[model samples]
Target: MAEPVADQNSALPDSPPDGQGEATEPTNANREAAKYRTKLREAEAKLEATEKRVNALLRAQVESLAAKELSVASDIFDIGGASIDDLTDPEGNVMSDAVDAAVKALLAKRPGLRNGSAPWGDVGGGRRGSIPDAPPTMLEALKFTRR
Candidate 1:
């Protein structure tokens, strides 16, 4: 009968280097992992808070631009179901061209939101009738006295 040979695959597991035991190695590794996980969580939380602030600032900028250029209320954007992303580029910067396009689209969809100013020059309260060529009353005669 042939003698059985020890295979490399069946050999004993290697021991930790430098006389360190396996138990202490795992504990140290776990502690480092836990520390890293805690730091990651904190960083993620700060990132989330920063993103919220950025979105708020971007929204404010959109509203202010809409009010100034479109002469419309901030609600106009909401009415169109448009979000901040629609008004911004990939870099999160507001694009004036995009804003104009969005406003145009909204105006087209809702004509009532047109930037019609207050009844400016003359709505009605001005002169009523045409001036009489022949000076009907004495008040008209005062014009000749001043000349």
Candidate 2:
């Protein structure tokens, strides 16, 4: 009532039995092909995941490092609100001596900036000379007169 399957080894090409057209044994090459395909898929998936992890880590590290560097720079250069208030006091009665000292210190640190006169030279120091009488234009007011 049932048909018997031929043994894999006994199914030779030259001696195929009746009802069997040809020997069709599963070969090592087919099995190896399937195994390699599975391995390739697994490797591609792992590579994608590793790339995602590395990108995320690098992004986080860059942001954290930038924030840290900004914090350090702020600590180093932040002059604070009080210093600005002191510098902006309008009256000539303000503490100009301290401001002058700070400017001199900065000029000393950066010697290249000392080529010109101080910004407050005209305010505190007496006028260098008298303006010429009957100054014709605004440009004439800026000219230095010999004492």
Tell me, by TM-score, which candidate is best.
1
lDDT, candidate 1, at 54 = 97
Total residue pair clashes for candidate 1? 0
lDDT of 2 by residue, 1-147 (tens): 778988986775565555344333455557888999999999999999997886555434433332332332121113221242343345422344544554455445544444333355446566677776874776655564532
lDDT of 1 at 34: 100
- Model 1: how far is 84 from its true place, Å? 2.0
Model 2: colliding residue pairs: none
Clash pairs of candidate 1? Answer: none
Put down candidate 1 lDDT per residue, 6-116, tens digits, no spaces.
Answer: 987569677666768875888899999999999999999999999999998998888777764355657546687778888898999998777777777887887777667
lDDT of 1 at 21: 85
Segments of candidate 2 deviating more than 4 angstroms = 1-27, 69-147
Worst 10 residues of 2 by lDDT: 73-82
Give the whole-model CA lDDT for all candidates, comma-separated: 0.78, 0.48
Best by lDDT: 1
What lDDT is obtained when candidate 1 is compared to the true structure? Answer: 0.78
